[model samples]
Target: MKTYQEKRHFDKTPEPPWRDDQDKGQHRFVVQKHQAAHLHYDFRLEIGGVLQSWAVPKGPPLKPGVRRLAIKVEDHPVDYIDFAGEIPQGEYGAGSVEIWDKGEFDLKRESTDIVEFSLRGKKLSGSYALIHTADKNWLFIRRKEV
Candidate 1:
């Protein structure tokens, strides 16, 4: 939480401020197309009280057998799930951001090596897997539809 707050000035950006909304029942998810220093997809899942985030450098793969690099990032406030705007040029992650997909998901499985989930989003609706590749690194892959 400290790292996320330290990286941005809420007053300078349209990003949401940290709030303690402890809604554990909300199993929501969001994918934001972020045009920062590089184009990437910000994948977030509402868990605990924050949004666990990952930055997929090549964006999320839409089909099975394709993989995209996902880098773990700081957890964001739950309110940030709906944020879509441009961050100031000097601020961290400064650039345009838009919601690519927003919906609910079910955590199917979680283990040391892999996480399996099913996302029911506007643009993405299917099972997906995140395989831990290395420290803070993972591979986001779409699973074949059942």
Candidate 2:
């Protein structure tokens, strides 16, 4: 996997996150200010040849039984980790960008094809899991003790 610093050149273009072929194994966590209540932070991971994304409304709750909505977004390139600046006016996600948290992860378990891993993030702190629902779809949930 390419380190976040190695993908700097791909950031020069404004194309979709998956535009260039150099985006393989890329992941990004984005904190956006929507036109609604509360700020949202997006957690995305590169897996199965696509960018698996989730929108945590409360920035990934820290307790059990607290489920945050993980809305999937367009597949973004792995280089997005280094993206921190204004997204320009009138754009779809027009807001300031910041690299909140990032690092490599390891899959701890998987049964019935569902894979789980320990997550390390800037705003989100805890162990998380990713379950593959379909060929191109997946669900991200944090691990909570019962």
**Clash counts for all predictions:** 0, 2
Candidate 2, residues 1-146, lDDT tens digits: the string is 23222433335534235445655543333443332233577666656455555655656555654655556556555555455665554454655555566665665675754656666565565677656666544556677854
> TM-scores of the models, in the given order?
0.93, 0.62
- Lowest summed lDDT window (length 10), candidate 1: 17-26
Task: Evaluate candidate 1 by giving its C-alpha RMSD to the native, one decimal.
Answer: 1.3
lDDT (0-100) at residue 19 of candidate 2?
44
Off by over 4 Å in 2: 1-19, 23-38, 108-115, 122-125, 130-140
- lDDT against the true structure, per candidate, is 0.90, 0.54
Candidate 2 vs. true structure, TM-score:
0.62
**How much is the lDDT of residue 120 in candidate 1?**
94
- Pairs of residues at least 3 apart in sequence or in different chains that clash in candidate 2: 26-78, 27-78
CA displacement after TM-score superposition, residue 86 of candidate 1 (Å): 0.9
